[model samples]
Target: MKYDVIVMGAGHNGLVAAAYLAKAGKRVLMLEAADEIGGATASVRAFKEYDALLSRYSYLVALLPDQIIQDLGLNFETISREVSSFTPYKKEGKDFGLHISRVWDKETEDSFIELTGSAHEGKAWQEFYSEVEKFAQKMAPTFLEPLRTRREMKTLIGQDSTWEYLVEKPMAEVIQSKFKDDLVRGVVLTDALIGTFASAQSIQSNICFLYHLMGNGTGEWKVPRGGMISLVNELERIVQSAGVEIRTDAEVTQVSTDSVGVRVQTKKGDSFTAEFLLSNAAPAHLDRIRGKKSESALSGSQIKINMLLRTLPRLKSGADSRRAFSGTFHINESYSELEDAYVTAAKGEIPKHAPSEMYCHTLSDPSILSEELAQQGYHTLTLFGLHTPAELFETDPESSKKIAVQRCIDALNSYLIDPLESVLAKNSDGSLCIETKSPLDLEKDVRLPGGNIFHRDLTFPFKEEGDAQIWGVETDDPRIFICGAGAQRGGGVSGIPGHNAAMAVLAKG
Candidate 1:
């Protein structure tokens, strides 16, 4: 039997790609190494006496097209909206809320200037930021549309700009140049490194900042009501409705290709053949499998930790009790303190300073998360942070992975937590209290390398225009395309890559 397309790993992108293909009247097959979908856009069942929100609202929804939501008829409760967040700052008996609302714009801007004495400099900061925002708003279309063809992107840029012009300029310089205040500069620079491995000072991170603004999951993030998994059931409905086959516990172990197209060898020796293939599995997993297709064109990966807590934390004098613990909490106490954390991370060691996290997925829409927990009568939390150098795991990991985690928690206390005595330890190693999971742990289970969520770094060289970069989705093989985060525009709940890959095969095949 022949298939018009075979999509591997039913991740958000892969599902979207397959669904679109089937909708266009193509025979689409989506395979998953695991029994479930929704990769990092996932929720774990509680084993301990605590609570957890079924779905996190500060989701990768920004990358999702508004029309896609409407067309899918996915549950309306699955999509709710409210104001986004508050970055709490309490130090030296002072408490403040870096409210993420547009209303807080004036106060937030004023507080930073006053805190850093940036107002004494000039009005240049005001003019520069306005321009940056305007430029970002204009480029919104490029971000919303998936890159299907070089010709399509060419229209967006002029022939005059050089490749270096696109990359060489640093994002830190862009923000700092406008504002002489170091504190204000650091605050603006925080946006640059949010979902990346690069520091504010790192190269090409300015682009990462651009994408961060795109998601803007700000304004009280929301979860699709009922349960986060309701999204899976809805998507599954669409897939089945569109005639896409479903399989669970049906893990693909090998992928082979020839003049006859492709053969997906499953662990049970069950064989799946198709004319075209798209993989939603992590790049790390797909790259390490013992097969021809296992050589995923991926370079490196990242480490992640998700937790469910019994109760929220308490901050001392400088802390804001009422500060909205909405989505993500930024824990930078000082400039050198933030840099020291990154410097330590570069050395494959955790910094002994506040490494930035008090983040709860609750900020998106805390009441929803709270209500969900109340229904189950337990308190839950999901915390995400970045540590480890870009290529830290390039070589094999030494010793057990637990040592590295301890170092990450230690790094948090150096500055952010006062006296180091007040810090609440809630499963510091991600093992004692909660079930620990990472890209490395998932490798044996799903056959991924370092268990990287995106499967490749979206730092640079991939998202830039006029470049023939093959980071994730773009490949040279006739019937090949990447559907997971390791593909184009990686690592988010957005299903753009999957959607784009299907459209490409539909147009070219």
Candidate 2:
């Protein structure tokens, strides 16, 4: 069949592109390899015995633009978190932790002072975040518009020193120069390491740090009200209502482009042709399917663990368990510790002290659980372990996963009064309610090459020399475009690439 545009994947970005194209009065067809859409944004009944819906892959919402929600009239909603983060520490036979609240009050400041043993560090924390806020404000608006040159972006930032530190220098230097406390520096550097395998000392790490902070102009990672699936469900509705046809279990096998248009053939012997083709698959995956040589070296590093607990684990720090788990809970993720783990992982060994983060989704929104589960104090815990690269598991996938999961649990246990295993809920069959996914598992489940969550490592938002202006979704073939995380500024849940791809197609006239 022939169509105006053929979108090759049903990921969030592809759905966004298809929805916009269909709404613009074009006939669009979206094909998916899996039976359902959303790709990494899917929420599934991961533990059937517990009656809980876990965001199996992508867990938070921060990068999606408000303009897309308003333009599409999406029914999606996210709850703002009160506590921003809590990092626990052990000192001189006593347990203490630092808490950063959304509303920075005296308690937050006191916690920082106590943990760092310096009131100066507490003051520095405010100053550091204030600078980040300014950076977010300057860069957030550029995300929705066409790609700018480096010079243009620097002009918008308006401060030579700020641009030099944030954009020109390595992120490690910025964190070290600004924050005196190693733990505080770790907290700031964590933003640069999310899904990125590079060290904060690298220039690429600066790009990752900027992308993490530029979310929605606030850098606040909000929780979707119903779960990540709600966003996908709403986008599916918009696409269907706009008359876009969607086909699942349609694994595309080939994409051939000519001067006039493109042709797509699926493994099922079905064929499609369109004037324009949009690929939501990883650029490397698309190259493999299209019989072309791939150029990018992309891999994801992180271990994701989903658990259902009968109750919150008691923290040694004596903070309110609900408050501690409500936001990002850091485990052994201090600055020196993070650098050590990175160095260990680079040496192809899983860090003994795995730097990880955890949060209880039920603490913020219990809607994902059944009423009985909620009443029974059952909650969902999503833990993410950093610095465990995909290569660590290439030799023995199962053994590496087992070791990685146990190390993460052990790291979390050091901060808790009780071992994490003690509070885990059990199935009727006596199995603990826990699941772990390594980068290898993600590659198998979602086709994320090397399990890299942001596709290839993130790219700078500005255009480089010899690149197409405004849009970064263009490919070597004029009729073909990339609308997935591999594109420039195409990481996280943001629909910018999809939106921009459609805009590129519309501008072809």
TM-score of each predicted structure versus truth? 0.78, 0.98
10 residues in a row with least lDDT, candidate 1: 158-167
Give candidate 1's error at residue 339 in angstroms.
2.8
The numbered model that scores best in lDDT is 2
Error of 1 at 115 (Å): 1.8
| lDDT string, candidate 2, 295-360, tens digits | 867588999999999999899989999999999998888889999999999999999999999888
RMSD of each: 5.1, 1.0
lDDT per residue for candidate 1 within 1-509, as digits (tens), equals 66778887776677778778888889987777676775555555434433444343223245565545565655534343332344444456665544343333565566555455565433565555444444444344454355424444334433223222223567655655566654445555555565456666766466566555554322123444444555566777888899998676677788777887888888878888988778777655555442435543332223454445444455432444334454445555234555666777677664544344444444343443446554542334444444444345435554324544554455443324342323232444444344434345545443445554445556431344556543336666666777766666665556656766766677665
Query: What's the distance in Å from true for residue 184, model 1?
Result: 3.6
**Native-to-model Cα distance after best TM-score fit, residue 189 in candidate 2, in Å:** 0.7
| Candidate 1 off by > 4 Å | 48-60, 76-102, 118-129, 143-167, 181-183, 216-228, 283-303, 317-322, 333-335, 362-378, 389-439, 442-448, 459-472
Whole-model lDDT per candidate: 0.54, 0.89
Q: What is the lDDT of residue 377 in candidate 1?
A: 29
